[model samples]
Target: MACKCGGYYYTLNVKASFDRDLNKRRKFLLRNVSVIRMFTSGFFRSKWRSIAGKRRILRLKALTVSLKALKLAGVHGIGIEVWWGIVERFSPFDYDWSLYEELFKLVSDSGLKLHVALSFHSNIHSNNGKGALSLPLWILEIGDVNKDIYYRDQHGFSNNDYLTLGVDHIPLLSGRTALQCYEDFMLSFVNKFESFIGSVIEEISIGLGPSGELRYPAHPFGDGRWKFPGIGEFQCYDKMDDLKMAACREGKPQWGDKGPQNAGCYNSVPSGVPFFEEGKENFLSDYGRFFLEWYSGRLICHADAILAKAAKILKKYQEREQTSVMLVAKIGGIYWWYQTLSHPAELTAGYYNTALRDGYDPVVSVLSRHGAALHIP
Candidate 1:
């Protein structure tokens, strides 16, 4: 039975101080870039799918009227996800911005600002394709040829939610690295929406990893493969050799090729869990320290690579716009594992946070270098 439970819903669509003048609106949108969850302008909402559900968004007339209402209600503007799957569904570098362009026009005519999320991941895992978008067909075709492009866990459970960081620089997507592909896609977006770059489009939420959050698809919900409260596993195994080589060079040759097995299976609790409980073989051990550091470090490297390219691209646009265009990156759902000393869940999910160390500091430092506002929903 499909649940038609629809009533009031939360939306990131909050109207900033309304400006009737066109130029004034542009400046306001550009200068104010703290766009965050539910009216931050950079939209980081989750409780509600969107103000206009997928079905209504598909209707042009409905979407047009929706924008008008938003403007009337004093909503500064709206943020929409430009899904890679739909835009570049046909081929590489081939983008069709017809729909979004029309949508942008509606916002403009209604005197509202806009922020676009350069969404790169599929929404399949969240709702099992209940009005969800899939990855680009062509890219998935390549994944068929090389499965490692997607994150595969030890139990051989493959999460096709996002591309693994291990293959970020490696050329697997038709002679182009994943990073290159993303760059190309973003470049195409800026070019396509050049008119709205500085004016209406004030902020861009860059999708760093799965579901646009900076984390591995360790405990994925797609197909119900992983249950909640379960310690997830390491993803992007292609980078294992690099970690192994580093370990060997660090006078820990025995650690080569052996990832952390102390992490219990999905649904394992903190108490009595080997790697989770603070004990001899737990995260307090010497081996644990090294492994977790390396694990989180790799994640940061991936963020640095993507955000470096993204920052460069946005900076050029910002210069052209002659206004401060805010760039945002999402790192949502910080775990509150106060019960476990080792924090096995965070360790497996690529966060080395525990009683001893702050795993997020280094990651935040990297984001700071790029001037990206972290959106925590």
Candidate 2:
């Protein structure tokens, strides 16, 4: 067990069992208790009233009284966001899984343990602050706004001014990409719940960036018909980040010969930079550590193709239910904006040394090579 928040650090693992005929009748029979500490939220926004059109009903006794008040407040786990614009809202390989089969049978009859965020963008916001376009309006009426498919920033804004979906026009309108439609929507949502993803679905956050958290969209909002004010820049000027900064300046020629024209290297102390004056090295802290190692190697190649398509659909449901399943990749933390500036001018800030060498150690070293797990609120 381990814990530490606001700076990040969480590790928990528990296992226990007993009862071999009560240990030869000595009389102490506790059997099977394994807890991988997880207590999430997002509760369930009722698909945000089906993206505001309303009438999507599914009040199973108010969702079994809110999963029996999160199993009497112990809350083993619950995170559910699964809204890809209300499960393929109005076509594109049609799908509806009837409100995730009644919220996974009321979260497996309230025994809890289910964490799925898959939400293809839109972390909600709107009240005038923006963000709230959970995509799917026919993927912005069949996209292609000149290929860079959204995400512009550097004052130009884009991402159609908030909400989400435009992570390169979702793999160019599904002809595949956007990590192959997130590994075909996690192998059609684990083959449409093959026995509750082989036993009460444990985790699968994988939302990958912008609110769902990874990076980019450090604030966007431009075409919801204009309305701006501080915040809204980082998005590394699209065109696949200008062909990955022209292949990282063709083998790093001091990242010069002209490259970054906008994506404003997260403003590393601009305005006559001279903070850590004695020897200089700023240039937006070396292009924000080469744009956070090229955006954490393109989000670790889309989290290794979404855990290799969720390990080939959890290996055909663990070869017809022999049991034993595990597929993680929650990832979503990164907020250190130089510990909120100010102090000897935040000790000559470079945005906390570009969030510890380009945003949280290159996204926790490429999501720890794949076992991935992080949710720092």
lDDT comparing candidate 1 with the true structure = 0.69
Q: What is the lDDT of residue 289 in candidate 2?
A: 44
Error of 2 at 252 (Å): 25
Q: Write the per-residue lDDT of candidate 1 for residues 1-377, one digit (tens) a residue.
A: 01111111111221111112324534343333343434523222211123332312345566567667767877776777788887887688878776576667777898877667788888876866776778899988877877778877767666777888877788878788889988999889888887788788877878988878888887786777677767767663653237767788779988767677767666677766777776787677888878777878888998898889988988877666464567887764646464456666677778777656556566556766776766654
lDDT of each: 0.69, 0.47
The true-versus-predicted C-alpha distance at residue 23 of model 1, in Å, is 42
For all predicted structures, in order, the TM-scores are 0.83, 0.30
lDDT of 2 by residue, 260-291 (tens): 34322333433333322222343235554454
Which candidate should be chosen as best, given lDDT against the real structure? 1
- Residue pairs with colliding backbones in model 1 are 15-75, 15-76, 35-40, 35-42, 36-40, 230-267
Those runs of model 1 whose alpha carbons end farther than 4 Å from true positions after fitting are 1-57, 236-241, 319-322
